[model samples]
Target: MSNASTSPFPLAACAEMLWRDRPIEWRASRLKELGFGVGLWNWPEHDIGKLEATGASFTIMNGYLTGRLTDDEGADELIRTARETAQIGKRLGVQRLNLHGTGLGDRGLPVQPIQVVTGVMWLKARDTLSRIVELAEQEDVTFTLENLNLPVDHPGTPFGRAEDTLALVSSIDHPRLRLNLDLYHAQIGEGNLVELCRKSLPWIGEIQVADVPGRFEPGTGEVNWNGIARALKAMGYSGPIGMEAWASGDSEEALEAFRAAFTI
Candidate 1:
């Protein structure tokens, strides 16, 4: 296998979503051998010693074990767990730690669903993120808040929309805290991706992708990933772009399709 990137951007694939029959370390090692970084979900599910032995460059992983961004109790837990995860992330040389508006439960549903986000809730969420920024700065690590889709995958998740995440991230305007900017979720919750990326350019720590309607690799669904790739290149946004999707068939073929779509 060749270990060279065709795209200018640093490409990664979530190991949790690919090669389901293989061991996690095998998946990570394979991705690294194929010239891609690795992404993970919750770290506790895998063996840290084995992961370290694989020597994969971990791009991102879930930053918290359990917590929400909208309330006091949840915020406290979020901070504590994120702090602990930061240590593990540093040990693994992971680039960014990922977070959602709230902890996701079985089937990616919100553990604590919110029907309406009041003005007070918005203020609280921002304050919570500010504290997260403090933790990031102190730990010398970056944390990203990812946008989720309400209509399809994650319903009732506070700040799940790209607009909401942008508002919150831009309001904080800190380097340690940045946006994960999942285009798959943005496509489901809001359209106008190019424009959204333009608006999100300054605060993006990383970009995540999966084709819409199936959460599979780029060519398997109804997303113009090639066009988006061109647009991103034109905008001078060369950063990490991760494939957080499942394989429609063969995982290797799926990864090749993803690389092709982003290789402008």
Candidate 2:
């Protein structure tokens, strides 16, 4: 239930991935026992009460939008969904809400990337997020714009690069709106991890870490986590750094390696 003020590098275990052996309701408490102050989750839904009972901080949860923000109709839907979820998040002591800006146009069909007229898509996304930011401002919640790797993990996603997401956030300049710089996706979409993180530090609200290629724990792939940690510390980014990755071996062992790599 603490942030950077309590620790040099605030870290959290991803509840969605780690501790799959146990019931989801019990995962936060397990992370708390591991000396982490925060736990990451997606879509609060019915889990708010269960997570609140654990007495650990739910660092961040997905906004859970059913449609892309690439169109007016989808944007309206996202706004409605986010506003509803934000209400539950506030009651559950969740600190931040993560959002994947847009989605593939038409699921269950051939995955064609949004290649035509990128400007229109960007403008639509901007307008869509503007409304979400208003909701976040009203609810006193923080919204994090997460960048995904298009044509890799996520095909046809609009905001696949860090620059595109940052541009959208900058255009809508608000205190509550910030970046969720996911290192794994960043590496896959674009390289130069430390530089990208350092440049985006000002707008960054939260961070997610995993090695590239396999998307496993740090040291398993080519990502230089030690250098990234130093960069974050040097830039004074003391926000919760989320371990969102697959376990290379035992989940606990993966987390232990995470602790050592991040020096938490």
* Model 2, span 32-51: residue lDDT tens: 87776554544533466677
Top-scoring candidate (TM-score) = 1
Q: Considering summed lDDT, which 10 consecutive residues are worst modelled in model 1?
A: 1-10
Clashing pairs in 2: none
Misplaced by over 4 Å in model 1 are 1-5
For model 2, the stretches where C-alpha displacement exceeds 4 angstroms are 1-7, 37-41, 44-46, 103-113
lDDT string, candidate 1, 71-167, tens digits: 8999999999999999999989989999999999999999999989999889999999999999999999999999999999999999999999999
| Model 2, residue 144: C-alpha shift (Å) | 0.6
- What's the lDDT for residue 55 in model 2? 84
How far in Å is the alpha carbon of 56 misplaced in model 1?
0.5
